[model samples]
Target: MTESTAPETGTPSGATGNRKPTPNGTTPEPVDTSATETSAAEPTAAATTADGASVETGEAGTAAATTPPRKRAARSPRTTTSRARSTANPSNETPAPDAAGEPSASAEQPGSVSIPQARHAAPDEVDSAAPADVEDAPGDTVDGDEVGSAATPVQGGGGVVDDGAERPVVLRLTDVVKTFPGVRALDGVQLEVRAGEVHCLLGQNGAGKSTLIKVLSGAHQPDSGVVEWLGEQVRFANPQAANKAGIATIYQELDLVDDLSIGENAFLGHEPKVAGFVKRGTINRRTREILTRLGHGEIAPNRMVRTLPAAGKQVVSMARALSHEARLIIMDEPSAVLAHDEVENLFRIIRELTAQGIAVIYISHRLEEIREIGDRVTVLKDGRTTAASLPARTTPTRDLVSRMTGRSIEYVFPTRVNAPTEPEELLRVEGLGRAGEFDDISLTVGKGEIVGIAGLVGSGRSELLETIFGARQPEQGRIYVKGKALRPGAVGAAVRAGLGMAPEERKAQALLLGEPIYRNMTLSTFSKIAKFGFTDTGKEREEAMKVADQLELRPRDVRRPVRTLSGGNQQKVVVGRWLLGDTDLLLLDEPTRGVDVGARAELYQVIHALAAQGVGVLLVSSEVPEVLGLSDRVLVMREGRMVRHARAEELDEETVLDLVMAGSLMEGAPA
Candidate 1:
């Protein structure tokens, strides 16, 4: 509840009105006039309007005014510079509302959020005043109120939460524009990243996020705009130049050499040298130190990069960035490949990095992650920043979604359909066992039922799915479809028995990336579309077009290469392939692995629709919540064994995680 003041005589000092003389007859302080500070420590206070309104910020940074003589300066501009910069420029990123509740032209800047300026005060800044001196430290208190600094929990790990507004901007982009042959990939993009803060970049695929990152990483140059590092404007000629200037980009597809050792990968291009000789010992020692700092000391520097898991590879990437002494590390979907516990560990590393005054540009499609680890957010849509520097935790999900997709969306799973009382079993695995991969797994998926498998990365989830699909020969198992046994090691036999699988690695296993979408979608039924042993392109495209419309494939073009589509669309094509065949049981491994929220919702609806049509669905997912929400029944896998099986309604995310993480020891507890 906000504390509001009743109306009083004379202009209220801090009530969105012109300031009147203090009750004690002291004049209001004069506004400072100076340039913005890039590295100076500024005071922390609750954000207020220039005319002294108590802007109470809430979800999505929506602001409401309150009556008060002194308003907290929440989201205030960098404390390193006083209110001087805003006064001198009058367009310092924060939008002010007019009588009509629209942003006044004088207060609005490019990429500025149109919402009223209701900046939320950090916990320590609730009762604080602006720093009285520019030279004061960030932790300095003012008028008995702790300001600009707070420590909070991130994904169950505690870390200092620095007030980003109080920190000096280390990287700034002004009206950055870039264009491809026929596309404007970035248009007048503006971003300001402060030191010691996680500035999250939010956008849907094709929203210019990739282009923006490319521009920042020196892979592409902006046709027009300013790129300022620290304080000086500089244009990098290539990725190496950017790295040399303390900027590192860790892309979703890590660029480490597989054959190289961890230490060698960490310092690939610029290995430590002494008198014109590469210092292998020095490189190993420093790599070990970096790994230790990242909380992964168990990984030996001499270990081959190819031997590391996805999470371990990510740690090596970070180590490589640190090896270059990067001040700002750009992470693109760093958590996409990580499991639950691995995601927590990643957040811990990010917090530690921020505490050391290193800035981070985090790009991800997961909104919950933005709330957990982000300090501020800049949203992009259609090659432009829709909103810049909004409070990450306070911003409503609807607001962010609207900015990214140009419309509000409720991210919800489809309504569950009740399974028939006497539904026929569509698929059954009796005593399924794959030596070293899985053991003694028995489960049944009834027609119109969705059965989900939940497990860790190495808990044999993917391997089990593949084995059931006949991609791998099981050491011992009886797989049946609609009561008929399937050949042990024949994918063709599995398909003939009405089984279709969308593998986890879609590009590598499911779809031919270089092939057109229609061709890829009709791969399973090409024989039906052939005439005299020749492929019928027209028939294949017509069949694919029907599925495309059902799936709502973007651009509605079937001739484009499968690789050109987004992650979600690629998965759709893979699933659509099964729709062409007489597939009664569908197997999905990480179906929504890299899909955005909007696409994920659509896919959920598709799955539900398939189940409603009496097609059995079986899937494996790293996200426990997804499994619980989408599945009718859940199976927990751990250490190559089936540990628990229950209806989805009888399980929750935490319970599932507990079983997956500690099920081996809890095997004796209960199913």
Candidate 2:
């Protein structure tokens, strides 16, 4: 014999009653008695026919249950007259359907529409059409595809979610709403995170992904909503409050002080102290332990962050978060500055955190990482949830990208057209070496050709560009432009020789963020815009507008501040500056690093167009796919030396990785 618990039902239990209490504790009754009689008198529509098909309804109140699923029953001409009456007033009477109760599922099945999966009904009282306000009681079984039980609360002290449970809620956001002037950045956004899960927030720019992170980190506050921590509702007035609550956010622009030592930067605000003074020795000891755990024992705690390489500096930032005992860490584009090996190290650390029951909120534009580290994903678009709580193992990348961009993109990289043949050599470098940075680099780029420079981070790719562009003086080498020898460290000579570079650090070395687009576009060609030591504003504006139009700059107003534009648009302005100068050689370093997908496609088109115009292009990027797809010829560099040169057709990711790992052509010389 089976023992069963009594089903909990309200006052009108198991009765086909005229009046029932709504889920929100209100009685909703039909105002007109005639409408109720009309609905019941009509024959009951088929719930589901044989072969799981549905019946069709017509204006004559006739139900055709035998209609095929592919074709709908023809509606009588009276349908238009019936629709007209219905449009005039919406009533409780069941609306007339053109064909079937289920509508046409054929068109939706093969397309982007999401179909619900089947699940077993609960053992308790079941409602086929449950009301919205009816909250499920604790331990009540729900449809697996529709609803899930609330996450298990955190167990550890200090509000940090413990790792012992099978599933633990690390972060909870309810009804989060944020607004900016005329824009509602986020409206009623809801999210739940579990310990040990890598939750990816997938969205395009301005999709409220960044805005949601801001609110969680206390950088912005929702005008309305309750932020719950470990099942307890709490309000974070500032980032410090969130930090103290064990939430650490690592933004794309790392907030570490470059001038300070690694240990000092890691423990900036909360330094180890003894009595009244900072304990330098104690801090250094603890710093070494953290770095060693992160597989970077070689990173000196005393070294200034500015002096270290880009990859090392990124690791230092991660160390800072770990030092704070961050239980829920948010990484925004953490791999943007990292090389392949450094990215591997970061994944190792992330895995270690998950093992310890910590949650990671990873936000990245790189789809490959989402496949590797993400356990679950949430996609947002236009400040609303397009998809929520999708398992990474079951979801396809194409689906995620479609949800994020709101368009079906067959390919991310644009098609490359044939570049010019028999182009002239615009710039040449021989034995270009910057001591300690890179060494013995030699390459030449011809006009109307795109030459790609590929290497792992810290391999001196950026240094080579700087050396050739006169930003950094090469200790030993000669640079020639159009067969003319150029002096090292002389910007005037480089620019006069018809060479221009869009530096890797766009904000620092390329554009004056505070300046207007027109000023930045003409900044490189100031001498041409000046006549007899007098600046010509008219010529500057005219030149700037021309390039802006060429790059498809929106607004087309050259006077707007560059800082106001998106990252992709700003990069275009920087590239436009050099293009306007009509430089014989163009050096672009990481041109699409932080740009969104749509903008990246546009930028690639611009780059190819520039190459077709006979502008010798030197492209430096860490993304192997970008180099392989965009360049006519690829040059792999390591330790400041040109290691391998191959045609784009001959180079694959494996071959490039082998070349990068081999570390220089000198190693391949007949030994």
Candidate 1 lDDT tens digits, 219-286:
66789876666544556666666775567888777777789999988888777566878889987987
In model 1, the worst 10-residue window by lDDT is: 83-92
Model 2 RMSD vs true structure:
20.9
Candidate with top TM-score is 1
Tens-digit per-residue lDDT, 447-485, candidate 2: 889989888777899888877888888899798888889
Residue pairs whose backbone atoms clash in candidate 2? 439-640
Off by over 4 Å in 1: 1-165, 296-300, 406-412, 418-421, 663-671
Best by lDDT: 1
For model 2, the run of ten residues with the poorest summed lDDT: 81-90
TM-score for candidate 2, residues paired by index? 0.68
